[model samples]
Target: MMTRAYIFLNGVGEKEEFYKKLDFKNSSVYCADGGYRQCLKAGAIPKEVWGDFDSVSDSEFKDLEDSDIILRKFSKEKDSTDGELLIEYVSSKNYDEIYVLCGLGGRLDHELTNINLLFKYKNINIKTEKELLFSVDRKYTFINKKNKIISFVPFSDEVRNMNLKGFKYPLNDYLLKRGDSRCMSNIVCSDEATVDFNTGRLLCILND
Candidate 1:
């Protein structure tokens, strides 16, 4: 398997089992400031930790200080979120994929913004206890979706010529928009299913 950069965002303790199920082999762990505390709680060592120490408690920061990990601190008054900064840094590392943990289920605006960050990379997957979300800029295929129902959401204003094969509710070159629900809750009929789009990006989510 290709190595993955695991991003530890805030709200790390929201789902314990999900973090436990994360595959860490050949993966470097990066924590976004306060998420480092959650990393310690999960008993995972972070290779690098970055962010302003605002959200992190004083004791937690001290805990990190006691460790010998690479720490990069920034002022609270920053241009971008800590998660975004870490993502950019990880992108530069040329990892095969970026797996984001605890990026969801936060403040409403923050959660939505985190989802938007999926567009930042072509090979990023956001995992939470409730769902597994990833973006599809061109085409994506999933095997073992025989009896599974996945949600196809258009990230942009419209994703033109969206097509799905081996699905119960097959869509051939269908147009999907932000408000369209036709593609939602589509059932997969075959062992191997495909979702392809000619132009634009969309989000695919498999409910847990």
Candidate 2:
């Protein structure tokens, strides 16, 4: 299945690297409100635009309409955030892989909500500004953080078979607690890292 890339403009930051990382040719791009400007700045035209006009100026909205991009405007009174709305749009399209840019480095609350959304859409490959968060079925996730540090946090009763390779504190068939930092600050000994859990939900954090 083709991967879909969504860009949300909370407040602009770097763009060149993000554009380079994304396979724009094979991916569908969605811009949320002010994100439209970011996409344009990156020389990408979004396939669809979503958000209330609160964040985007009138002229910008006109520019998007003039450019023929599909726009889905929502009301400010809605319960969902613009990022969440865009996510819903992508989910309905059945895209298995999703890369989100500009969702981080913004408001703290918004960033937290975006992170929580990872759990909401557990089946899709979701990449954010600072990390890649995705779940394998309802049990496991392969996370790549930004600084070569990996952390394993259990969200269920217990996570067994918790083998971790390429780390300072390597484990074999270990059990993790719901609230523990034993799995934190581990390093990757190899180029590729691996984590396996027997049962329960686990959040595997890996730093790149």
lDDT of 2 by residue, 73-146 (tens): 88899999988888877877776667666766668888767766766764444454455555433333234422
Candidate lDDT scores, in order, read 0.82, 0.69
List the candidate 1 regions with Cα displacement exceeding 4 Å.
none
* Residue range 1-208, candidate 1, lDDT tens digits: 6778888888646556666777765579999977787777766789999999787898878878898888899988989999889888887788888878778766777678779888886567887777789888698888886878799888788899988998999989888888888888888899999999888778889876
RMSD versus native structure for model 1: 1.6
C-alpha lDDT of candidate 1 relative to the true structure:
0.82
Candidate 1 TM-score versus the reference: 0.93
Provide backbone clash counts, one per model. 0, 3
**For model 2, what is the alpha-carbon lDDT of residue 110?**
82
In angstroms, how far off is 140's CA in candidate 1? 0.8
